[model samples]
Target: MPRKVLVAYGTKNGSTAQIAQIVAEVLSKAGLTAEALPARSVTSVSSYDAVVVGSGLYAGRWHKDARRFVRRHRRSLAPRPIWLFSSGPLDASASERDIPPVPGVRRVMDNLEVTEHVTFGGCLEEGAEGRIARMIVRSGKGGDFRDFTAIEAWAAHIAEELAGPESR
Candidate 1:
């Protein structure tokens, strides 16, 4: 059977979900069978050979459901290849340092062998921001900063890593 992978995400306003979809698409194009779904919708990862989990970063934290999903399935996930990502930071100024999983999240990642943890720029649509965020955006700092080229590059790299020697 072909190796199967799951690309699951926890999102608010759907930016991370879009990123997850693209990641799954890239992986599928690279020769792996991949499925992208919401984190809450995935009941188990037992049948997947690998998993890619992502969440929208909010106030230096991952969405609760995404964190819980990993915590809930830690045992089932331990033996699989796992990769993590976050979509946040509305400015080009956001750096790799801004992307590490939050404290509670780090504890979960510490328990497993995570292949990679990436932080990608996110989008903030008009009227989607809270009061403070609106102020920030009004200050001219907010925009759809997601870099599709970088995103696709990262996904392609993941595809190569998970595709194995035969596919390579």
Candidate 2:
């Protein structure tokens, strides 16, 4: 049996939403029931055994709706294991220590006590699309830097951690 998992997300240009869907599917395939829903639509977290919250970044900060979602439900989430993910950071090749998410983002996780936080590169748009990603990562900086294999791999780890050895 799989535990109910809520994968909530907030996206601006739809890239992060796509990433959330991929993560939900990956977790589902790992024997965990996962559903991706927009942050504004998810009214309650009481039903889920675990949660994975992700938000797209804009202007070097998390999306506002995503911040609100965590603030609204942080009390409920503290008792349960929670994982936080941010779909930003155009650079993906940095060493673990060099990740800005450490000191820069510690305060964000402190309120919710997220058991883990993951950062993946943001998605880019081509010339005709004219998405924000291209503007931010100009000068040949950004692209669709999401690592599908890495995403699935982490989801599997989360599933195993939550389900326990006996269940797996």
Candidate 1: 10-residue stretch with minimal lDDT: 93-102
Query: CA lDDT of each candidate?
Result: 0.82, 0.75
Q: Count the clashes in each prediction.
A: 0, 0
- Residues 31-150, candidate 1, lDDT per residue (tens digit)? 889999999999999889889999988888888779888988999989888889888888874444455666766776788878878888988776764786677668877778787887
TM-score of each model, paired residue for residue: 0.87, 0.83
Report the error of model 2 at residue 123, Å: 0.9
Please list the Cα RMSD from the true structure of every candidate, rounded to 1 decimal place.
Answer: 2.9, 3.3
Cα error, candidate 1, residue 14 (Å):
0.5
State the lDDT of candidate 2 residue by residue for 3-69, as single tens digits.
Answer: 8989989887788888788888988888878999999888899998888888877777787778788
